[model samples]
Target chain A: MRRFAALVRRDLRLSLRAGTDATTAVMFFVVTVALFPLAIGPESTVLARIAAGVIWVAALLASLLSLERLFANDYEDGGLDLLALSPLPLEAAALAKVAAHWLVTGVPLILAAPVLALLLDMPAGGFAVLMASLALGTPSLSLIGAAGAALTLGARRGGVLLSLLVLPLFVPVLIFGAGAIDAALHGVAARPHLLLLGGFLAAALPLAPIAAAAAIRQALS
Target chain B: MALPDRMAYLTVAMHRFANPARFQRIATAILPWSAGLTVLLLAAGLYLGLVASPADYQQGDTVRIMYIHVPSAWMALFIYANMALASAVGFVWRHPLADLFCRAVAPVGAGFTAVCLITGSLWGEPMWGTWWVWDARLTSVLILFFLYLGYIALVNAFDDPVRGLKAGAILVLVGVVNLPIIKFSVDWWNTLHQPASVSRLGRPALDPAMLTPLMVMAAAFMAYFVTLALLRTRAELLNRRIQVLQMARGAS
Candidate 1:
C-alpha cells in the first residue's frame, strides 16, 4: 500500500516536473474546441448542438496524445525492469501509474472542459452532467489507454496504432458521456447515462490495470 | 468408432492437427475439400437466397441484402468468439496452435466484420433513410470490427513475434467480455434500433423462409472461415519453421 502511494506520488512529481504533458493536452483540448467556431462560422446554435461531442472527442484525443508517455519513459530507462522486480505487484503498479496519469492529464482536461463548454454555448443545465460525466469517464480513458500504451511500448508507428486500438474502446464512454449532456440539454433524465458511465469506470478500473500489467509484462519479457 | 461417433473422431483429428507438422499435413489434405465445400455451399446459398427466396412484402427484393449482411455479421461475432476462445486456450493450456489460431483468425474476422458493416450501411441507406445511425447495435458492431482491427494490428506491431502474440491474446480475452455487452446494449436501452431477432430469448422472430438460407449461408461462411484459417495457420507455422531452420544454418 505504501509502495502504491509512493509510486503514485513519484509519478505525479515527475509529471509535474516534466509539465508539458498536462499543458499539451489542455492546449489541444482548447485549440480543438476553439477551432470549431472558426470552422463553422460562429453560429451559436450549431455549436451548441455539437458541444458535447466536440468536447468529448477533444478530451479523447488529448488523453490519447499523452498516453504514450505512460509506460514508454519507464520502460526505456530500465525503471520498468526494477518495478517488475519490486515487492509490489504488477497490477498494483499499473493501477498507481494509471491513477497518476489520470490525476495529471485527465483531471486537467475535466477542469478545462467547462470553459470550452461555455465557449461552445453548451446549455447551462448541462454543466453538472458534463462535470460528472468527465469525472466518471476519464479514469476509464487512462486505464484503457494504459493497456494501449503498455502494448505499444517499443512498437513502431505506435502513436497511430495506439489511437486505432484505444479509440474504439473509448466509444462506450463517449456515448454515455455525450448522452448525459444530450439528456440534460433536452430537459430529460441524464442520470441513466451518467450511471452507466460510472459503471464503465468501475469495471474498467479493475480490469484495465490487470490487462495493462499483462501487456507490460509481455513487453518487458 | 461407430458411425455415430464420427464427429468425436473428427474432433480428435482436429485436435491432433493442433501439432504444427500434423496440422500442416491435415490442412494440406483438407484444403481442397474446404474450398470445394465453400464453393458448393456458397453457390447454393446464393441461389436459394437471391432467386428462390421470396421477396418481403415490406422490403421487396432488396431484402436479398439480408442474406449477405446477416451471415457476415454472424461470422464477425463468431470469429471474434473463436479468437477469444483460442486466446483463452493459449493462455491457459499454453498451446502453440491456440496462438497460431488467433493469429490466423484475426484478418478473416476483420474482413467479415468489414463486410457486415458495409452491407449494413448499404441496407440502412434504403431502409433507415440514412447511411449511418448512432444506433446502439450498429455502433457496437462497428466497435467490434475495430476491436478485430486493433487485435490484428497489435499482434503484428511488435518486433518479437512472441511478444505480439501474447499481447494480442490478452486483448482478445478483454474484447470477448465486451461482445455480449455490445450485442445487448441496444436491447437493454430505449434505442432507435429493433431488438435482436435470431439471438433473442424467445423463439426467433425471423420468417421460416428467411431463416433457411440464412442458416445455409452461415454454415457456408463458417466453412469458409475454417478452411481459410487452417490454410493460413499452416502457412504461418511453415514460415516460422523455415525461419528457425535458416537461423540454425547461419549459426553453423
Candidate 2:
C-alpha cells in the first residue's frame, strides 16, 4: 500500500514538474467547449440544450490528448522495464499511474466543466448532476485510457491509433454521463444514469489495470 | 488411453495444423470446397431472397433489404466473437495461427459491418422516415463497426509485426466486454429499434417465408466468411515467409 502511494506520488510529481500534459488537457477541454457556441451560434437556448453532450464529448477528447504520454515516456526511457522488475506488481503500478493521471487530468477537467457549462447557459439544476457524473465517470476514462496507452506503447501513429482504440470504449461513459445531465434538465431523476456510471467505474477499476499491465508486459517483451 | 494421454494426443493433433506449412496444405485442400460452397449458397440465397420470397404486407419490396442487412449484422457479431476467442487462445496458449486468424478476420468483419450499417440506413429511411436514429440497437451496432476498425488499425500500427499482433490481441480481449452490451442494449433501453425477433423464447416470431430466405442468406454469408478467412490467412502466411526470407538474405 505504501509502495502504491509512493508510486502515485512519484507520477504526480513527474507530471507536475513537466507541467504541460494536464494543463494542455484542461485548456483543450475549455477551448473545445468554447467552440460549440461559435459553431452552433450564440443562442442560449441552443447552447443549454446541448451543453451536457458538448462538455462530455470535449472532455473525452481532451482526456485522450494526453493519453499518449501515459506509458510511452516510461516505455521509451527503460523505466517501464525496470518497473516490471520492481517488487510492486505491474497491475498495481498501472493503477497508481491511472490514479495520478485522473488526479491531474480528470479532476481538472471536472472542475473546469461547470465553469464552461455556464458559457452554454446550462440550467442551475444541471451543475450538481454534471459534476457528479464527471466525478464518477472520469476515473473510468483514465483507467480505460491507460489500457489504450499501454497497448499502443510502441506503435506508429500512436496518437491516432489510441483514439481509434479508446473512443468506442468511451461511448458508454459518454452516454451515461451526458444522460445524467439530460435527465436533470428534463426534471427526471438522474440517479439511474449516475449509478450506471458508478457501475462502469467499479467494473473498470480493477479490470483495466490488469489489461494494461498485460499490454505493458507485451510491449516490454 | 488415459485422460492425460488423451489430452496430450489432442494437443498434438491441434499443433500439427499450427505449423504454417501444414496449415497451408490443409487450407489449400479445403479452399476449393469452401469457395464452391460460397458460390453455390450465394447464388441460391440471392435467388430465394430476391425472387422467391414474397414482399412484406406492409413494407413491400423494401423488406428484402433485411435479407442483406440481417445477415451482415449477424456476421459482424459472429466475426468479432471469433476474433476475441482467437485472441484469448493466442494469449493463453500461444497458438501460432490464432493471431494470424485474428488479423485475417478483422477487415472482412469490418466490411460486413459496413454493409450492415449501410443497408440498415437504407432500410431505416423508408421505414423509420430517417436515415438514422440514436436508438440502442443502431448505436450499439455503430460502436461495433468502430471496434472492428480499431482492431484492424491497431494490428497494423507496429513496425514489429509480432508486437502489433500481441497488442491487437490484448485489445480484442478488452473489446469483448462490449459484445454483450451490444447484444442486450435493445432489451435494457426503451428505444425506437425493435427487440430481438429471432432469438427469443421458443420459436422465432418471423414468418416462414421470410425466415427461410434469411436462413439461406445467413448460410451464404457464413460460407463467404470462411472462404475469405482461409484465403486471407494463406496470404498472410506467405507474406510472413517472404519477410523471413528477406531478413535471412539481408543477414547473409
Q: Which residue ranges in model 1 land beyond 4 Å of their true spot?
A: B1-17, B190-193, B200-203
A71: Cα error in model 2, Å: 0.8
Global local distance difference test of model 2: 0.93
Candidate 1 chain B worst ten-residue window by lDDT: B10-19
lDDT per residue for candidate 1 within B87-198, as digits (tens), equals 8877765678889889988999989989998998898888889899977788888889889989889888887788788888998887776689767777787776667688
The ten-residue window of minimal lDDT in model 2 chain B covers: B10-19
Q: Which candidate is the best by lDDT?
A: 2
lDDT tens digits, residues A59-173, model 2? 9999988889999998989999988999999999999999999999999999999899988999989999999999999999999999999999988999999999999999999
lDDT of 2 by residue, B121-202 (tens): 9999999999999888898889998988998899899998989989999999999988898789889988887888888667
Residue-level lDDT of model 1, residues A52-84, one tens digit each, is 999999999889988988999999999999999
